[model samples]
Target: MSTADVTSSTNDQKYEIAHLKLVPKRHIGRMIAAAIVLLILAAIVRAFSVGQIEWSYVRDFLFAPAILDGLKSTLIMTVAAMGLGIILGVVIAIMRVSGNPVLSSIAIGYVWIFRGAPALLQLMIWFNLALIFPTMGIPGLFEFRTVDIMTPFVAAMLGLGISQGAYTSEVVRSGLLSVDSGQYEAARAIGMTQFKMLRRIVLPQAMRVMVPPIGNEVIGMVKLTSLASVIQYSEILHNAQIIYFANTRVLELLLVACFWYLVVVTLLSIGQYYIERYFGRGSKSITASM
Candidate 1:
């Protein structure tokens, strides 16, 4: 080609400079309206004198070490329950997907019973297990044989975590299902062992799918920790109750508990966003990095 021809072609090349596009001004109006609504809510709260409580009293005894003790129990129960629930969820999820009819049926029943019953009722029943099955010593097989291995705390853990597992099992099963079947076929075609395929391929993929719902469950578990209060587990809500009972400032004391809960849930939600983003980055549909 001649130099003139090449120069003409190069001159035809185009580059588009990107500019910041603005949203409609009515969107700003909506935002201002939202701000006004929030201000109105704040005014209502103030009008009800919710924040007029003597800050000194709250600072003094409201947040004493004993109050913090309740928060500690809340954390302990939450961690323990979530840890146990995840384990149980994995087991049940696997059972749910198993080829065996009996195993799958049993897992289904387990999920049904727990999900059907109220968690609070379950907690009460567990707490009273000590009364139900007092003791049964076996011959000489073991030291205690059928030992009286029931405590209020242990019972509460079982009730909470087991119930949570039933719900989480479904979440996990959905996650596993969301993974493309072709991935499994490919894994099998490659002669990967079932265990190997599950560990090396399936679970990681399922976990990515599980992130959003599982994050919700984690936050729900944090709030569910309050249920342990029925058994006197001294969680955040329990502490708030103790303070409220002492002073009868129910709303204000409850606000303290709500604050802690809101803080924890907010942090968990932010963590969930990052986790979901991490998994989302793996999506094939996404051409651009987030």
Candidate 2:
């Protein structure tokens, strides 16, 4: 109740508050775990760098003419297959979302068949399609023997493109479905045609969701092109196999192929980052405002 008693109590409280620790406790366990992981990673890097990897052979063949040719083929195939796949995917996704039961069922069946089968099996089937149908053509139109047209290139394209379309259709369908239903209703009320509505409103908004996955699919398509080698298509891995088969430097050739694949995928990943950012700008702005 005295003035000195009150002053003494306030000063004691201030001293206690000032002495309290504010910093978070260091997580010694996490620090120790991280150190162990780094040490293990360093050991693995050192072992591989100094191991019997034939780095000289990898360097020598990295830019070899045959490898370069194979790289070119791989790039071309990836672009062509992805282009075809995306177009088919967009069409199929639209069909799946259409009101007609027949169109939706057809799209669903196509996606089911392609996605259910392994891509390699599809390639084999396309390559050996002659067994099922010696000739392929319109019923009343000119026909060609399946074997005559079913080259490695054709088989690879058909297999990769169709298979990719199945997956891409799902991606596109999800993106489309992510758009608010009210947006569709608004577009319809504004006298927009279905195609015009998709082009101007739904798709542009859905692209923010679609671009990332589509980019991943594009990068995956690059690697998937390697499977064409099974059918003897002259992609990067096929060329690497040819070189190593004669030279008995399999690991070196494989490393070279891996280096190129990493380079291509890295480039693609960078492009994807930029594309995602571009499409995501509006969403980011809306989020920030909210």
Candidate 3:
């Protein structure tokens, strides 16, 4: 009678355990937060759709001559400014990491002044350089009136390019530092000059570390070109403003500007992804081995 009773009790316990249901955990707070965000986004979409905005104006101006011209100007400035910035940044980065105190100090000061000041202020100062220097050139060889030469485009270029150099130098410096000292020593042992060593051995490797941030900075520069509007450099925003002021289609013109910016940024982001993937190939292989 006791053996039968123990066997029956064990069988019942096992059956109960097998039949027990697992209840999944609910993330109530996460669901509620997501719902709230969706609602807010829906509201914003509805507001814009039903607002007094002239959607037709936005569509028409999106591809208008003025906008296209502005876009061209923006792209030109981006390419030119970034080219200048890269040259300055590389030189400054080299100086920053060099043995000479004078060059290092000069590089530091350049970064300090440019990075410290707002881009707008720099643009204004450049635009108004005639106040500081009536003319610029070699004293006996050539001279030109500062006001004539310092047009809005030139001023914007100098301002944006120089400011970009300050930030890019830091990125470059970090990339250079990330390289192994052993590589530097090896380059030196091979009878390589400093310039030759950096070009042949260092920069190629450092590009892996430098590409991502530099790509991001390029994207940032696209948006930053809007600041040129203040100096009337006729980038998209400035052109949009001119249109809106005349037609009183401010929001529509702004929307047009925003659309173009998003398009350019999206294209740049795709390019950035490719550049990042290319540079990251070596790191990925190393990581896989580990």
- Identify the candidate with maximal lDDT: 2
lDDT of 3 by residue, 120-235 (tens): 89989999899989999999999999989999999999999999999999999999999999999999999999889999989988999999999989988998888889998999
Candidate with maximal TM-score: 3
Worst 10 residues of 2 by lDDT: 281-290
Of 1 and 3, which scores higher on lDDT?
A: 3
Model 3, global lDDT: 0.92
Off by over 4 Å in 1: 1-39, 48-52, 61-63, 136-139, 142-149, 284-287
CA displacement after TM-score superposition, residue 144 of candidate 2 (Å): 1.4
Question: What is the lDDT ranking, best to worst?
Answer: 2, 3, 1
Backbone clashes for every candidate come to 0, 0, 0
Q: Return the number of clashes found in candidate 3.
A: 0
TM-score of each: 0.80, 0.91, 0.92
- Residue by residue across 115-197, what tens digits does model 1's lDDT show? 89998999888877656556545646543312245555676788999999999899889988988999999999999999999
Worst 10 residues of 3 by lDDT: 281-290
Q: Per-residue lDDT of 1-290 in model 2, one digit per residue for the tens?
A: 99999999999888887767699999999999999999999999999899888888988999999999999999999998999899999999999999999999999999999999999999999988999899999988889989889999999999999999999999999999999999999999999998899999999889999999999999999999999999999999999999999999999999999999999999999999888877887686656956
Cα lDDT for residue 218, model 2? 98
Q: Each prediction's Cα lDDT score?
A: 0.81, 0.94, 0.92
